[model samples]
Target: MENPLTPDALLAGVRRTRLVAIVRGNDGPAAGRAALAAMEEGFQYVEIALTTPGALDAISEVRASAPVGCFVGAGTVLTKQDVDNVAAAGGQFIVTPSLAPSIEEAAGRGIPVLAGALTPSEAYEAMNRGAAAVKLFPASIGGPGYLKALRDPFPDIPFIAVGGVGLDEAAGYWGAGAIAVGLGGPLFGDAGSGGDLAPMRERARRFVALATQYDGRAAAESLR
Candidate 1:
């Protein structure tokens, strides 16, 4: 079987989750629990935010405990130090809230960096930076239509839709050319207060099911 959690394999996991929960809590335990729940719920990609306490430790712990198919990534990485931290923690990929030049430096080592972008120009520049994919952040404000518009000119770039993306709108974004979607509070709620993870797991499972259904339809059409 092909390995799906490798840095190069993040895209497949993206289709499965369509919703990556960014978790940052008071300590390693909280982050681990949140990340564990996300994986249990069928989410293959989990991001432990750099702002969280012991983020790298939490990532290493989660990476060790998570099922083989799960992809653990570091989020909100801003500097070369953050990149080194995640890499040392064994994180397969890195995600930033905004495009940064340091991100290019990190990705050069074969680590997949999902650089955030708000415009076509930004997205194109991010791709030029050797980014594995461009994250369309605050996508709600831009909307799925914006992604579709961007695709007309820069269709080859892999776009991960982020922010304000929920089950109700995931399909719209995917249909509009988004390769994946990143979700937060809606899926996991607040980490500081510690959410009821069982419900979040169910919600994540439903997202996988919904994305699978959409993929089925799309594949069928393509075969015709």
Candidate 2:
């Protein structure tokens, strides 16, 4: 396997991709397959949430086999131990559902974190603690209007809209000034649970096409 990219380099990759795929499943191998499939289809920044069974193993497996320039990371990370396990499994990045201690722990090890937050204070606090970007969790509640409002205060902070984000709502998120859009259920469907991947591939293709068409900058590295 290749050496992990530095936090800045990883962030650059994320910035260039403008999409993050969150994978969750009932089993390890299945989740790994789902991740690999997404990576193959241009979802380069893939996160296998720790909530999935045997996620660490999946991370280890995917890290060793992911496509070049694809990143395998652990998500829904809630504690320090989770961070340690992910790092040990060779996860190149870390993502949290909230402003958990794992964010600081991962940052301490030079691992980049997409710290999750909803409120303005929480988002600012996450960035203050060294997060490479802020993940606006449960972003559905307020929609693009809310994201736009948050950007007003933190004009320079990169915000990734997560939770309840789907294909239909993606353009709104982007227009609202999101640096990247985080996706899970709408993209994965039941693929991670041993469901058919053909449909998943189709969905991913549509997403990639939309992203590349919407932002040419993201296409430069994401489509290649």
lDDT of 2 by residue, 4-103 (tens): 7677887787777779999998988899999999999999899999999999999999999989888898999889899878888989888998889998
Highest lDDT: give the candidate number: 2
Q: Which ranges of candidate 1 are over 4 A from the true structure?
A: 1-7, 15-19, 191-193, 216-224
Which residue pairs come into collision in candidate 2? Answer: none
Encode model 1's per-residue lDDT on 1-224: one tens digit a residue. 11225446676667555656778766666777888888887777888888887888888888889886777888898888887778888787889888886578776877778899998789888988888788999899979899899889997898999898877777788889888888776676764236566777777777767766776235323222
Worst 10 residues of 2 by lDDT: 215-224
Provide the TM-score for each candidate, comma-separated. Answer: 0.88, 0.94
